[model samples]
Target: MDLAFGADDSKKRKGPSKNWTEREIEEELKKLDAKIEDAKTNSGDVEVRDAILDKAMFLKQEARDYPEAEKVFREAYVKSGGASKKMELLFEILLMNIEKFDIDSVKKDVTLCKQLVDEGADWDKKNKLKIFEGVYCMLIRDLKRAAELFMSSIATFTCVELMEYKDFVFYTVVTAMVTQDRKTIRKEVVHSPDILAVIRDIPFLRQYMESFYNCEYKQFFEAFVEIIDAIKRDKYLQTHANYFIKEMRLVAYRQYLESFKSVTIENMARAFGVQPDFIDKELSNFIYIGKINCKIDKVSGVIESNRPNKKAELFTNTIKSGDALLNRIQKLARALDI
Candidate 1:
């Protein structure tokens, strides 16, 4: 009765400890696993399902378990009833695989693209798919196919709401032009007014037109008369002309600089249907403003020139590098923020 309890006896008297052992922790985790499975099977809330799927994907990605991540995405797609967000995620995964340049992966992406296109993906989305196709074609230097796809994407934009689609269209046109396919150029002109405007604005095109007309004056004049008559009869031409003039100046310096190296004032003057003196004056002004470097040929009263800086070249390149006419129209559209 008078004796104090030993430490072991005192511990026994305290009974079981409050802290959980590893076994108990495992048991709790198993219970949580069951609960999560039940929730997944029965959850009607889209947001909750999405959240769970996202968590799973993130965890798998963190674990560097791509197969598991893909499984999660597929489950999410089914669970969410093919939500656009889930579809986008799936597409992004496919895109990443494509970036690896695995031929198998690219073919898979191409198939997916076709499926998506068939599944009523919006025009804007289809345009993106076409861009990927174009990229693939470009990598192989199959420029003709690339240009065709780019043009197709541009056509798709006629139905889409995004301004970026138009930008892509312009870019596609430029890409085609850079490859220097005159047939493609002519086809684009026939199909796209925006392209026509760009062609009309291009210094090289103008020079070509002038030289051609000067060489075949009667036929050129006849065609010119017909065009003028058509424009006079149609109010649309006036609108187009006004719009073209406004945007033409945006690339004028660059266009002039690029063409000046190979084009004479006489060439451009004939192209514009203006006096050679007028062309000379304009050329002098361009030189003064550092838009171009004018090299005068004393005997011929002719000048040769080139862009004095990269900035000017870039502008010209942007305009003329792809589908010239389409790109110009697109640029004009962008400038108007339309």
Candidate 2:
């Protein structure tokens, strides 16, 4: 944990203490604080001051006093002239309390992260900062941006680098599902075979994707339920769980509608494991908004697609074929001219 200060005087004096009580840690921090002040006044050695502050920061974190730890880290970071590790840790401390961060603080950290990356910080640190930005976006309820940032971070990483970030990928997939932006998701997530493989490694993710792809509305809902705890744990998802659930249901309902010329509300309700009333309301919501391109026949209890009639469909297909044939002949004529 004390990566910055590898050697400490206490450790050399009495090997390393395996178990230090809270009182002992507090005492150590008090002594280190005094030494840090003395080093500032007497030796004026920034390195010595930074080392003392690092030990104090470590002890503060161990004592679960994160605000105090952040103060110590900020001081050390200033003395060290913005060392990469210290800068990364500073951002990390902010990320740990993302919900408490204000919009200005979040924006400041984002700018710092970009500056660090431009100055050639390590890949691990870069990805960590990128993930922090994504988490910040999630905390702010900007899910579309969060999904894109998470994708960019993971896309540049090797498989070895991705193991530590499986949870982030889970967040990205859930964001994609919630936003239902298939164009972006397909380009960013599904098209990347390696990333897809990494994603499928999670058992629940695999189930969700399989069921969603196969349009198994019931199975997809079950898969979502299985990961409900995870959704609750995430700050953004927990806040918008109802919205996500509602949107995903519409997606499932639309897919179900694609398979039928007409289906009863009761039957659709059975497939989605919802009450017929709920299905009726959801269908009305989508249909009114032109999302489902369908109508419900209340007397017949049937929901139907407003697709073209057979003759109209045939005429549309013929026009499309003719256009394609004309384009091909133009290409052939150009080749002949060449």
Against the correct fold, how does model 1 do in TM-score? Answer: 0.37
Candidate 1: which stretches are off by over 4 Å?
1-42, 45-49, 56-71, 78-87, 155-175, 178-181, 187-338
> lDDT of all the models against the reference?
0.50, 0.67
Name the lDDT value of residue 48 in candidate 1: 51
Candidate 2 has an lDDT of: 0.67
Off by over 4 Å in 2: 1-23, 41-49, 52-56, 82-86, 99-107, 118-122, 155-164, 190-201, 233-236, 255-267, 270-275, 286-293, 304-338
Per-residue lDDT, model 1, residue 229, is 36
lDDT of 2 by residue, 1-338 (tens): 21111112233222233567878887977877777777767786665656666664564445656667666666666665444656555564564355454656777767776787787777777767767777677767787777777778766643222124566667777776666455666677666675676766665776676577667777887787766656655545676666667777777777778789889999988887778999899889888887788889999999888865889889999999999999999999999999
Which ten-residue region of model 1 has the weakest summed lDDT?
1-10
Name the best candidate (by TM-score). Answer: 2
Model 1 superposed RMSD (Cα): 24.8
lDDT of 1 by residue, 1-338 (tens): 10111111222222223455657645744554565567767775575566556544443333334555556666666665433444455564554444444446555665666776676666556666666666556444465676787776654544221123323443454345434344555566334665555444322333333333234433433444433333233221232333333232323334444544666667666755667887677667656766556665546866776436888778888878677788898999999995
lDDT of 1: 0.50
- Give the Å shift of residue 144 in candidate 2: 1.2
**Residue 95 error, candidate 1, Å:** 2.9
